[model samples]
Target: MFLSMSFRLRTEVEALNMVEAMGAYSRHRTVSLLKPRGDGKGYRLVIAPAVSGQAIAFGYMKSLVELAQQKNLPICDQCRNYESKGGFVKHGTDTSGDLENLVRSCIVEDVTGFMIAKAEVRRTSAIQFSYMTPDIDSSDVAIDPQFHVRAAKPGEKPQPFQVESGTAIYVLGVALDIDKIGVVPDSNGKPKIVVANRAERVKTAIQAIAHLLEGLSFGAKKARYLPVYDVVGAVAAISHPVPFMVSPARISKDMDYVTKTVLRASNYVKLFSDAKETIKLFYMDKENVVGEVKAENIDITKADNVSELVLKIIEVIEKSLRD
Candidate 1:
């Protein structure tokens, strides 16, 4: 069943900036915000749906492949620094091509130029996220001035460092086609089984997404802080494709209403499936987390079970993670 997941991300000081121009006058420093649809200016946080989907795919694949890429170390297996330690393997699939195959199928290889050529586009990413708009009206937003001191070397002079901070309840609605991807037995019997099925593929992709998004930091000064998501998603009782993006206004915070809206919307589109929303919270750090986001929150780290939930939500469509 195709399922839609939508939720509010209440972020604090998520430092996002797409700089068009720069100057030494810190007060004049500009940060991008979501402009209305017809406006010409682009916003970094309120991203385009297509780009968001690709970014999701990239995030997911990057999470899945990082270990192998790190251990494999060098690009071009021919590099002299490369020793044939036979350690460049993920889950026993030691070959680089195998890893590349999985990555290219779902994500873009823009992580690096070498990965770009190798990671040719395969199955288009099924996850579609809408332009994440703030739940509250833009006029209600309050921007606070952040002040800092520029650390200068002996040869340089100091300057003022100021940035504006804004907080909003942003909403993102995503539709995932879980019925399309599944895991089937490997033709070559390597790595035990293949994750190419639509159900399995979607599961893997979502898991990757959950991993990437957890403790995600973006824009400038990424090290300072991260965004937190009060996430919710619904799975259908049957295979109903949520192909369209519903705006935040039309969405209901109530879980039942959310499910019904999805059902009705799908029916109108002549698509049929049942789904329900499961609620959870996601955060960045595992320790000292002084913020309000709880540690008990799901999908906290790479080690979390967030990935398995994808399969759980699609149990009506496919029961097995590996088949």
Candidate 2:
């Protein structure tokens, strides 16, 4: 099973992710992209603040470690200590030279993947994250430097610094291959399940995703500048036998992205009509930001919040596992 999701986040006065501090100014990560001009003539370049995929992935891994520990799943010493700066685990020394031992012994390594530089053995991660960036179609995106100062003594000068803060409707996309957890490819390049409790591991993986989004757990600088954020809207797609990516919410502000993604998924499903390929969609529209969505052929589930939506998806996954 392959799961893809896209969500809209509204953050105000947030310095969630930042680059190196240059002098007294701390810079927020920004990217330049070409956007269609309102005149319908040409495209213009827009520089927008963004949160890196690395940052988001790190946060997700942290949540994964916590959930795995709660279930008494094995985690390497390095990952348990939250070492290597980004929740990276050390490669296990498998004396038998079989990489399967490495994955079977540690849930973190199995899900996030790792590379043995000396041996040149690498495992691709089952989960993927896209950079959290402002919606290109929205006109309310803005980033500016906020000035701050440290407390001064009776006769001492104040220490002042600048940090970039942003306000925008940001979009984030994530994908996970549920079948890959606790499974490794064999020497013949065929998938092999190395762990015995595959269902438990898969459910934990899904739960970690819920913990990450619902808790708003990703990003940095929460000690001082915690961004006021809300999940404005979201859409998720689940497919079997073939990978299907949902359309991102950043495409346009005028159209409902949820309906658009369902239509696209419906078309994709028809391509494999003779096969067992199937897709299911779920969406949540808070504050009526997405308005009404219109589609047919497939049923779309609606949830009142993020937790409820994830629970519905988990039910489908559990049923698939039983089959």
Candidate 3:
């Protein structure tokens, strides 16, 4: 039930609030907010969640889409390129349900890479940027759950290690992996389980959630909550700093509905930013560069499997880190 609500709220009311909240989140997080693209048909809000930018972006966008739908606002078009029309946009030409025609228009535009970047381009929305470091005093750092310990055991089902050390330790150079699985043995010899990706899935999830967290914080004007696992992910630590980016856009046709759009956008950003930030603060080094992205052009046709490609990227990152 809680899970359902989480997903629903994220896709509805919370989404509307994102537009109004963007400036505050950016200012407080101490991260960077890239210039919003206002050129072409719509606006492009891009963000880089040093920790989980991608997941964060997804969460924010998903929620915003729902909110706009409920309010009779133009549905948001998820485009791979800000300047390209790969998604749909609404035009007043259709007599279908106001939202329905809007959706159709968007679909048509998306196919051609011509989207209304901003619903009303005459007005410009202002966004803020913020970045904050953990209260660590040293260059070398490691972050573990205040309650998590033990290298993940191998298997389909995994159990948390009896943490001999009560406090989660922070370490540098250990990378977080999301969507990974680990198994522990039961008394009968059956392995209990925990699963995520080996490494890439972990990173992708991490980036996704981090951007969400930052968005939430920027909007709520207070600390936001997230699942603890998201904070740690598969990465145990980093020796470099990763850049985080947050960008919010209305999923609606007019972009006039700031409440739902902003809310959803902020939530998504905060989810990703918090997890990413926590990992960076708890585990990564000052020198390590964290990568945050507000927007990217995703070519679904170009990849055989989006999920597989993401994981493969993880393999590459892992290999690079190990070297």
Provide the RMSD of all predictions against the true structure, rounded to 1 decimal: 10.8, 2.4, 26.2
Q: What TM-score would you give candidate 2 relative to the actual structure?
A: 0.92
TM-score of each: 0.51, 0.92, 0.20
| C-alpha positional error of residue 222 in candidate 1 after TM-score superposition, expressed in Å | 2.4
Cα lDDT tens digits for candidate 2, 48-71: 988999988888888988898898
Clashing pairs in model 2, backbone N/Cα/C closer than 3 A: none
lDDT of 1 at 27: 29
lDDT of 1 by residue, 81-125 (tens): 123533222222222344344433322221211222343423333
Clashes of each: 19, 0, 133
Worst-scoring 10-residue span by lDDT in model 2: 89-98
Report the Cα lDDT for residue 127, model 2. Answer: 93
Deviation from native of the Cα of residue 26 in model 1, angstroms: 8.0
Candidate 2 local distance difference test against the native: 0.83
lDDT of 3 by residue, 1-323 (tens): 00000110111111111222322122112123333344645543333212223223333334334333444433344322222543222332233333223323332121112223344211111111122111121221222222323354576444342111011111111122221112223458674432222232223333332334323422221222231211211111121223222112112233311233223334444555634422111111122222231222110111122233334444444664356
Best by TM-score: 2
Q: Which regions in candidate 1 have their CA more than 4 angstroms from the true location?
A: 20-61, 66-123, 137-139, 178-200, 217-220, 227-238, 241-311, 314-317, 320-323
lDDT of 3 at 61: 39
